[model samples]
Target: MLRTLSIRDVVLIDRLDLTFGIGLGVFTGETGAGKSILLDSLGLALGARAEARLVRGGAAQAVVSAEFDLPQEHSVLDMLAEHGIAVGRDEPLVLRRVLAGDGRSRGYINDQAVSVSLLRRIGDELVEIHGQFDNQRLLNTSVHRVLLDAYGGHGDLLAAVGAAHRDWRAAVDARKRAVDALEEARRDEEFLRHALGELDDIAPEPGEESELSRQRQGMMNGEKLLEAMNQAAKDLGQGRGVERMLRDAVRALEPMVEKTEGALKAVLEPLELAQENISEALLQLERASQRVDLDPNHLEQLEERLFALRALARKHNVTVDDLAVLRETIAARLAEVDDGDAGVRKLTHAQAAARKAYEDAAAALSAARVAAADTLSHAVMAELAPLRLGAARFSVIVAGGGDADAWGEGGWDRIAFEVATNPGAPPGPLGKIASGGELSRFMLALKVVLSKADPVPTLIFDEVDSGIGGAAAAAVGQRLARMADEVQVLVVTHSPQVAARGENHWRVSKSAAPEGVRTRVEELSRADRQEEIARMLAGERVTDEARAAADSLLQGTES
Candidate 1:
């Protein structure tokens, strides 16, 4: 519910502040007294398009702010929270907009700066303005289905349809992915099998290349190594030449030892030690030469193994170390190819089940909508007679069963509020068939019937009593009052009956000021309200009989 509106430098409304309360409030003024300016200010605060002309002449900017009190569970609270704008449960939601003289604008919510689009979205949720020229919400066929569902209280059914739609879409995506994988694997089937065959044939092992290279290096120099060992052995008396000479010298020294006494004893000991060392050296050389391998056939075999491993590595574009891993990967791809058909078939079955679920949920929602449409049409028709629309016909057309392209999360139903202005006339869209006055009355009747279901907390009707008077105008006022029991209602009316029906009344008038003409609104007292209504009934002059009639209308509403 809107609690207050503040306007600054907005056209004729130079600086105006007004407070509002629950139930019906009426703004009554003579022609050109700036009632429209009041609404424009409210619109500006509600994120309407900012125009340079809307800014008062010679003023730098125009500002308007609207404050509202919303329920704790209102969807707008969640929306604000999503945008990082926190609103406490008891805190009022304030939306303000400033329009510069150059047509630039800024919007704020709860004193926090926000984009105009966001402000507009929240404004849409909080207030609905219905006039002869501003019936977009009821006229737009796109929102008709949503309005019908809301009226029918189909929250659970809508949720079910949404969930089913999501599940069906997910299943479709999964099946498409599986089918794509199967097709790709089939295209590469022959290549995979052939590559696996080559890798299996070679059967390369990890580190085999390095081990083979090491053995090949040793074998490549085998002949040179053996020749050097043989030469060293020959130099160290391999044929027993040094050992034989040493033993012969030792024997001669031993025989002369007795004759030479002590001198011969020292020489004999040294000759025996030299002969022992030469014998051990000859044994070591013979053992070393025995282990040297000089066979060319073994070296050729080693080279063949090493080269084959390297050639296979280069052919696969992988090192010898990665050949084993590559073989495993190839085997896995081949396995997938062999099982691709079964995987795709399983996914296809799941997709079918998901589609069935979605169809069932959508069908149920559609059926419920058809039933609710009849009830809503009847309810709205019942309201038409009291508002001087007895000859008119109101209906809710729930159309379904289009092609798959027309299906949506909200089900397949196409709902519209259609009306026929005269008896036997073919019903057409609400906006196209009704005149200015008829459209406003039609909206009022709909609002009266759907008051409890409408989520908007406030409803503003401009020129709702455009052409109706006497009993018809009083009927319009009574219905507006009835709707106010559920939501806040504000009407800009010239009808005395409507003005007298308001729980609160304000008189809008234009006055000449020092600078220029300015528009002002005064909240009328009980006595003041009677005068305003009389002024509405008698025009420029308020007659005694008009005052008496206005008093009676006020009393009738009170009763």
Candidate 2:
């Protein structure tokens, strides 16, 4: 439901604010009293195309905003959620639109910026406005099935159909992903075959690069370490070396100090230990020198292995280990294309299965819609009589053979609402066949039917009661009131009878403003409401009889 509308510097409206309430609320005014201006302001705020002309002459920008009280199940919630906009539970959604003199426009929802297209999409679910020559979603042939299902209470079936459609599409997408991948593989088949064969020939191992590098370095450095270790071993272990000289010296000193003291014994013990340690170290040095095989052939072999890994790395643009995986991948690609017919057959079978599933679900949904159409058409026809189109014939024509691709909300039926003013004439498109007033009545009749099914909490009719008065006007008013019971209804009307039928009324008037002209709206009290109706009845003047007639109209419930 639209809770409030605030306008600033938009066309003739300068700082106008309206707070709407439940039941039927009517806006009444004379010609050029800015009734149309109010609706235009609402439309602009609801994401209609922005126009520089709409900006007030002296103003740099115009702002129009509408706030709506939406429920959980309302379609607007999902749309807003899809855009990542937060809509608190039971919180009002404020949509603000601003247009600058330069023709730039901006929109916001709950203070969060939103694209105009997104705002427009969310707006469609929030409000359905029917005005002079303006047909809302009801005129769209696509939604006709959903309408029928609503009337037939086929919500469960519709959900199932939607789920099936999504699953089928998913399967098709999976198959396509593989096929696209396979096609890309096929493009590189020849090059990959050779590359895989090359890696197969070498078959380099992980860490082989660093391992071979260490071996090569060891072989290259063998010459420098070989001579040094051999010389040290010769000096330490050969005759006249440290071990033989130290042992002889200890023997000589020990004998000379044999009678002197135990100090001579300590020196002898240290010399003996040092000689033994040098002999053992000399043997280890000789062993290490022997391990350094200066065989140049081994060095060449290590160099060859290191260069092989590097060459392969450069050629494939990958490290040596990655070559293994690369070999496997290319081989798999070659295998896939090699088994070409097999893959194609698999994809073909999958597509066939998915298509069959989609077709079955679509067929079921289509049948349900056909059944729903019959029930909905009957329900809508019943609503039309009370709306004063009793003699006029109406039909919800569902043209069969709608493409399965086009099957969505209504299972692909080319639906059109047709009407005939009299029983004998053939029914044509409702919008073209009915007069402006008749179109409004037809829209009202459809809305009254749809309100019972759709989750939208408010319905606004901009001059829906136009070109209608007298008995027909009363009927329009009553229908609006009846529809209001299901959801709030705000009507901009000229009919006094329609004004009398409202549970609440707002009188719109234009006043001279500092800028130029401005439109203002206010709720009407009981006595003042009657006087406003009298003015509408008498036009520019209020008399005793007109006042009495307005009173009678107001109290028409007594009759």
Candidate 3:
């Protein structure tokens, strides 16, 4: 519900503040007294188009602010959440707009800057303004289906349709992904097979490269060892053998030892020790030469295997350690290619099943909507006669049988509320068929029928009682009062009967200010309300009979 509206420098409303309440509230004044100015200000705050002329002459800017109290489950809260705006549980939704004299404008929600389009979107969900010239909310074809569903109480069916649509879309996506994968794999099938064959032939094992290298080094060292042993043997065998030379020296030393006593004996002992050590060294060298491996063929085989592994690793752009894992990966790709057809077939079947489910759900919803549309059309017709539109015909058209492209979560029916003002005329869109006054009444009739189902918290009807009087005016007032029981209602009315029906009343009057003409609104007291209604009934002059009639109307409403 709207809590308050504040206007500054907007048209004739130089400065004004109004507080609104529950049930029906009426604004009554003579023509050109600025009742429209109040609505214009409200519209600006509700994100209506901004124009330079709307700003008061000589004013730098025009400002309008509207504050509303919403229920916890209001859809506006969800929209705000989606936009990353946080609102406290009890925080009121405040919308404000500023129009500069140059035609530039800015919009704000809860004091945070926002785009005008976004503000308008949020406004559409909160308040709906219905006037002869305004084609909003109910007149919009896009909301017709939603309104119908709400009226029909089709929450469960709508949920089913939504779920089925999501499932079908998911299945479709899964099938497309599988098909894409299969195509890509087919393009690379030849390369994958060839690489797998090479990997199988070579059969490179983890750590095999290091093992081969170790073995190759050992073989090369053995060859060098054999060469060194042969060189040592040649040196020893040159001239006399080392053992024979040592024996001759020792014999010669033994004879001299007898003559030279102990000194000669020391020399002979050392020569004897050297002769024995030389004989042992020759024997050990021969044994070591036999132990050394001189197989050049084995070394070459190790080099070839190691080099093959290294070259293959380079070709695949992987380290030698990863060659075994690469082989497994390639083999997996080949397996997928072989099984691709089966995968695609399975997904295609799933998609078909999902599509069937969605179609069934949508068909059921369409059936429900068709039945509800007939019932609703009759109900609206029942209301038309009371509002002086007896010859006019109203209808709820639920067009179905559209193609898949026309299907949506809301089901596959196109809903529209159409009307024909004359008996022989063909029915057309609500906005195009009805005149300004007739359109307002048509909307009122629709609102009365769908009052409980309408989600907007506030409804404003501008001159809804236009072109009617007596019983018809009374009927319009009673319906507005009835609708107000379900939602807040404000009416700009010239009918005394409608004004008398208001639980709250305000009188708008234009006055000559120092700067020029200015409009002001005054909330009426019980006595003041009767006087205002009398003024409405008497026009420029109030009469004793008009006051008496006004008092009786108030008493009738109270009763």
Best by TM-score: 3
**lDDT against the true structure, each candidate:** 0.89, 0.80, 0.91
lDDT of 1 by residue, 124-212 (tens): 89988987787457788987887899999899999999999889889999989888877777798898788888889878789888898
TM-score of 2: 0.82
Q: Using alpha carbons, what is the TM-score of model 1?
A: 0.83
**In model 2, which regions exceed 4 Å deviation?**
7-16, 49-65, 73-87, 97-122, 142-154, 180-198, 246-277, 296-309, 334-344, 386-393, 397-432, 509-522, 534-549, 556-559
| Candidate 1 error regions (>4 Å) | 203-326
What is the Cα root-mean-square deviation between model 3 and the actual structure? 7.6
lDDT by residue (tens digit), candidate 2, 1-559: 8889899988777678888888888899888888887878888888888879888778989999899887767777778888898788968899999899999999999899989998888788778788867867777765765677677787777677677667767777877877877788789888988888778888877778878887788888898888788777776767777888987897789776758766678777888888888878877887888899689988888787778878888898998768777778788888878886577778778777876766676677667767777766777788777667898887877675556666553344566677897879899877678888778788888887778887657788877777657887888888888889889898888888888988888898888867666777788899998999999899987998899999999999425
Scored against the true structure, residue 66 in model 3 reaches a CA lDDT of 98
**For residues 449-534, could you state the per-residue lDDT of candidate 3 as single tens digits?**
89889899999999999999999999999999999999999999999989999999999999998999889899999899888889
Q: Candidates ranked by lDDT, best first?
A: 3, 1, 2
> What's the distance in Å from true for residue 462, model 3?
1.0
* Residue 485 displacement (Å), model 3: 0.3
| Residue-level lDDT for 538 in candidate 1 | 84
Give residue 27's error in model 2 in angstroms.
Answer: 2.0
